[model samples]
Target: MPKALETLVAAGLMSSLIFPVYAQVKAPILPGTGQSVQYDTEGKPLTASESSLYTGQDASFEATPLRYQDNGDGTITDLNTGLMWQKSHDTTKRNLTDSIAVVEAMTLGGHDDWRLPTIKELYSLADFDGELMKPKSGKESKPYIDTDYFDFEYDRRRPFAGAFWSSTVYIKGDVQNFTQHGGLQGGFGFNFADGHIKSYETGKFFDGTTIQKSDNMFVPGNYVRAVRNTTTLYDMDYVDNKDGTVTDQSTGLMWSKSDSGKRMNWVEALEYAETATLAGHSDWRLPNAKELQSLVDYEKVDFPAIDTTFFEVTPSQFESQQDSYYFWTNTTQGDFKHTAVYVTFAQAWSKKNSDATEYFDWHGAGAQRSDPKSGSPSDYELASEMASDYISIDNWVRLVRDAK
Candidate 1:
């Protein structure tokens, strides 16, 4: 017997033609299956009841907040906010007064979703209509900016202007170089002349004057734009040294160290840290000197102003290298002295020379020096073998780990 006929006969139901006719009509399929059902391509998928939701709205409703520019992605951006956003791009450092004012103005609008823009939000706003100029509000909806975003009522005694301020603090100089680590080089492309976007590193400019080789001071007043951090850094574990020295758990670095007065070389200290096998980590390096100093608590320092809970150290750590209190730093000064710098929690001062200052030359690279106090020659061998010819005398280093 044929298989189809046998099944039909056993079921005691359909004839052979009935089975063929049933097969001819395709079975109903569930949604998302390959089978086609009814759906409108240009409209949303909705049941008859759901389709009636928007039926009673008046056709004469006009959009509020004055002007809107199509964002090309089916969304629209406001021109008022655009102007404010541009001003923020012009800023380098964060100005709480400006930022809060902008946020307050935005909150007054009907849109409650408006919040402080993130770094990327502001970063994306760069590179307006080519040539570093901002997009203007014209027929092109060309990056519309409203002149009425700010209230200059206090300026009645002065002159009234239509321009408004942005929440972002724009740094006038090529501030990109300031953002680098270890070396101050390379920056994202930008148009220097008109503040436009060009390439990944278009406006690469450096204020060589801001960097002091004589002293490790970076000019704090140079305009710097502060960007609100969007992504929260997570998975970071802080090392609790329990003394006065803290280390980064991920990279096994002394997260931050205080320098009172110490003679330790940064390179040697970093090498020591790199070789350290703490908690199964071996990639420790010297924390940028600033990272070390951040641990200091100026309000409370018996000897060195430092946070006691997070660090591990004793007065003996500064006494000598084997039990030295002095710590080394990777930061070099532009002094004619071959001398490098260090930070010791022992005395709590940002000094020019370390403990072994008498050992190095004034301007020469070799390890030789004329004593300032005794006026005598001295040959000072490094207390530790972890030093190179490039290393300066009396340089002590503290270990640092990358923040996880």
Candidate 2:
């Protein structure tokens, strides 16, 4: 019995009873969602947010909002616009070469992986044939999200749209290829300054000219829209045709040229287009909204109306103030009783609307302005200063000719 007891004690099974043993203590482990909380060798918990380990596939732990999408394709899609563009897109797209490079090198959202959108991806946001008057007032969905991407210091909504360039090559018939619109749509089927999905509409305007939707597709030149990208600075130069029509070099499209003092109403601008003559060229017509928008330079705020070269002076008699750097487009909104869309050079933005009555008089089957010397004036006024009598209210008018 003594030997057996000694054996049990040696085995330690009865050692606790034999020796005055203390209670054993164990640390408690908490249950969680399996996301590991980091710790040092001493077992102290780390303060970092609980996240999955960096798997090479989805290693974009530091990407910022509107910065990147971990597509797991070794490349990430730009969250700002859902474009998975290559680095080359930035280099070749337009004036955004430096901007893209800077973004690429940034350690944003905690990761250094960012790139411009490819043509296929970037143009995917176009709203071809969508309503121009209310271009971006649509519902949102998963595959399509119309969110503003440009956050430049000059203009908060620089990336929204005017016109942008895409990386895709537009191959027209007869080996005539063209650069894709920044919105990747044809004609003015280009994308909106604000990101939104668009539905198709008849490309034809009041006149018989074939206008293409501002999308990535090809059609006739019946209608034209405007666009600009961060990669380039678009300048507007005016051609002073002593005749009725004036040519806007920014779009290579002409509009009825008005003298700085001629206060012809909308009718006059149309008439100027109707009676224009340049180097034996007739067939001139007043530019529609998109055609007018094509000439706006968002970066340079001076002389926002049309191109400076086109005008001896900006028209101030129209609704928008000369300092406002915005003017009316020929296009009218669907049902806004007294409002019309206009472009502002202050930010290269095309999303502002002005009043109709104060800046213009729709008398004599056309439009007229306080400044009668300028050719034709669209009927509109600035939102803030409803005073139409200000002759110094600078504005611009452009003309267009049939593409034939």
Candidate 3:
């Protein structure tokens, strides 16, 4: 057995063996977030002292680094996930139905097994090194994806038009009215332009006079980038170490069984994770965007959209409304320093409008969004005009470390 496995086994035994003993399971490897640069709370590049001050940030630890190879043909291969991708996406945007049809008819790279990627698979291409440029800043915005490895472009007319469709549907539906059809079925998509995973309506749109096909309609649609060899579905195999930590045999990562159990700003959360010592290990660090998102168990559409069996989760109360909390990731938003990425393990709430008193789940559980790194939730303006009136500046923390 490997040294890491032996260590985990010994640790498990020492802690009083629990039911379902530690066992290895083969699972898809998750690629790193491709974020190498460290940032301070303000989004400025971190100095050595600042980096040390914030010891357990994303750049401090390394996972399986992202590796991609572009075939001379019109395809790119992600070495980490063993998935081949279309080098360039169709310029024309389509609804979910049409997007699926396009992939069915696609015969790229001399192969016919092309299909749409799941939210996780598509998210593997996200690169935090890219910068989000302010709209009308007269500066070109950098995309959250690697433009060199894959073809990418921004819609000059619609600044944030880079969302690519995924096969996974947002379980809570389209309460946000992202498309012409309001309050309808929706599917998840990744917007590389601004760096978020959101749900877009999948139904066809109706013009003032009549319903229109996606090809002729001007309603909201998403780009398509076909992928192949997606044989593995999303799965997480977790084992309870029974010593305040859990091991995911699939990804070879061990995590704190419980969260900080309190709300904190991004900097505080980072420091909390870095300085944490748990389960007789001191190498814990805050997970990057990808690492943190991998823990979300989308199967649970209710509160705490994770496997509560091995992890402890607590809901935060706001105005008598109990809601799942947003957990911070070490990655800073590409476009701005004031914001950091977070994954909503449960319902992502939004006010009905700026004047509304009630809040509803605008984005479904497992959605990925950004939050202000510091200050009171009310102190900052909405992260984006498209965002809900509600925002949560103070978030939660969960620490992770490579099993050794």
Better of 1 and 2 by TM-score: 2
User: What TM-score does structure 2 among the candidates reach?
Assistant: 0.32
Quickly count the clashes in candidate 2. Answer: 71
Better of 2 and 3 by lDDT: 3
Off by over 4 Å in 1: 1-267, 316-325, 348-392
User: How large is the C-alpha RMSD of every model relative to the true structure?
Assistant: 25.8, 27.5, 10.4
Give the alpha carbon lDDT tens digit for every residue of 6-77 in model 1.
887877544432332111112211111010111111222223233322111111111122333332222233
Q: TM per model?
A: 0.28, 0.32, 0.84
Instruction: List candidate 3 stretches off by more than 4 Å.
Output: 1-28, 177-182, 204-219, 231-233, 316-322, 352-357, 383-385
Error of 1 at 76 (Å): 29
How far residue 218's Cα lies from its native spot in candidate 2, in Å, is 42
Worst 10 residues of 1 by lDDT: 28-37
Clashes of each: 58, 71, 2
Window of ten residues with lowest summed lDDT in model 3:
17-26
By TM-score, how accurate is candidate 1?
0.28
